[model samples]
Target: MSDIRINISNKTYVLAHDTEQFHHAIADLDFTVHPQQFVCLVGPSGCGKTTLLNMIAGLDPHFEGQINIGQATQSPTIGYVFQNPRLLPWLTVRQNIEIVFDDKPPTSLIDNLLDNMQLFDAQHQYPERLSLGMQRRVSISRAFAINPDILLMDEPFVSLDAPTARQVRRLLYSLWQKRPHTVLFVTHDLREAIALADRLIFLSPSPMRIVSDIEVPIAREQRTDEGCVEAFREQLLQNHPKISELL
Candidate 1:
C-alpha cells in the first residue's frame, strides 16, 4: 500500500441554527504517514482530532484541501474504530465482524481474527452479553479483519478501566505487529500515545494545527516498560516545554 497524504488548509463547521456563525475546526494542517507506520495525533479534547479523522475517512467532506490514501489506481480499504464499540446488539461477535465484508468471508478468517483477539470462545455471544472490554476487542477484530490499508482509531480505549485499557493496548500492538497497516490513532492521553505510537504529532487547540512532529525514540518493546515510557515523557516535556502546555 502507498503512503497516506493529508493536507488541510482549513475546515469549518457551520452552526446548526446560525448560518452566519461557523466553528473553525482545523487549519493549515499537513502531514503524510508512511505505509505500515503507526502515528498518533495527540491533542486536547475537542481540538478537532475526530473531525480530521472523519474527513480522512470520507465521513465528512465539506473541508478545504485533500486526503489521499494509497495510489489513484488502487482502491484503498479504510477501517475505523470510533470512541465507542459500535456493534450491533443482535449480532454475535463473529457476525459483527462478518458483516463488514460484502460477501461471506472465509470461516477461517473469522475464526483467526476472533482467536487473535482472544474472543474465540465468546464468538457466539451477542454484544450485550459481553463486557465492555470484550466488546471493544470485537470492534478491533472487525477493523483488522477488513485488512485496511489505512486504519483510523479515535481513542478506542478511552472508556475502559485502566487495567482493561492496558490489556487492549497490548492486544492492539500485537495485532499491528502481525499485520502492519498505516495507522493514525488519535488520543489526548500522553502516556497512551507514548505507549503506542512510532511517531507523535502534537496539535494546537481548535482551530487545530500541527505544533510538533516527533519520532518516538523508545523502542516498541521498551514502550511496555512504564519506567522507560515515563522517563522519556518527562525528558520530552523538559525539552519541549511548550508541548507540555498544549496537552
Candidate 2:
C-alpha cells in the first residue's frame, strides 16, 4: 500500500468518576500520508497526537473515524516505537528483535540491520546493560524486523540528552534511507519536526484539529550538514512565523 487515508469525525472520552464531564480529543481531522513520506504531528502535550497515532495502528479502536491502509486487503502491518525503549530485560538484543518476526528472517538481513543501527557489537548484550541510546536503537531494530507498511513513532526521542538524541536521529535516518516506510512521527519540538519531516502538521489545542500542513521542499541531503539545518530552520520560521506560537 502506498497511501494511508485517515478521517476522524470525532473522538471523545468521559471521566468515569464524574458522569457530567465529557472530553473530546479530536474532531473533523483528515489527512493522507503518501508512501515513504515522513510526516510529523506537532502540538502541545495534551493535544492527542499520540492518541491519533494509536488509532492508526489499531492499538486503540474506540475513535470515530476511518483509517484506510490503501489497497491492502488485510490490515497493513504496523511497527511502533514508543517514547520509552520497552525492551525485555531477559532477552538479548538480537533475540528481542527476532521475536517480532513470524518466521526467521535471513541471518544476513538481521545482521545488516544491527550493523547499520550500530547494534551489532551490542547484540549479545541485554537491554539492562546497554545505554539508553543503545536500548532505543534495539527498540527501533525490533520494530523494523516486521517490515511494517507504516511506522508510528510517538515522541521516540523524548528525554534523551541532546548528543544522544542527535545520534539516534541520525541512526533513524540511515535506517530509513535503506528502506523507507510511510512514517508518522509525533513530537512537541518544532525544530525537531522541521529537521526530520517531509511534511509538518501542526495541531491545535485539545479536540485536536490540524491548524496547518506545510511541506518541506528542501531535500534531506541538503539538511544533513549543521549549516544547512540552521539555514532551513531560519527558512521555516521566516516563512511561517505562526509556528513560533506553539514553540
Off by over 4 Å in 1: none
Among the numbered candidates, top TM-score falls to 1
Per-model TM-score, in order, reads: 0.97, 0.94
Cα RMSDs, all models: 1.0, 1.6
Candidate 1's C-alpha lDDT?
0.92
lDDT of 1 by residue, 206-230 (tens): 9999999999989888989999999
Q: Give the residue spans of candidate 2 off by over 4 A.
A: none
CA lDDT, every model vs. true structure: 0.92, 0.86
What does candidate 2's lDDT look like per residue over 36-108, in tens digits?
8999998889888888988998878998879888676666889999998899889999998988877866688
CA RMSD (A), model 2: 1.6
Maximum-lDDT candidate: 1
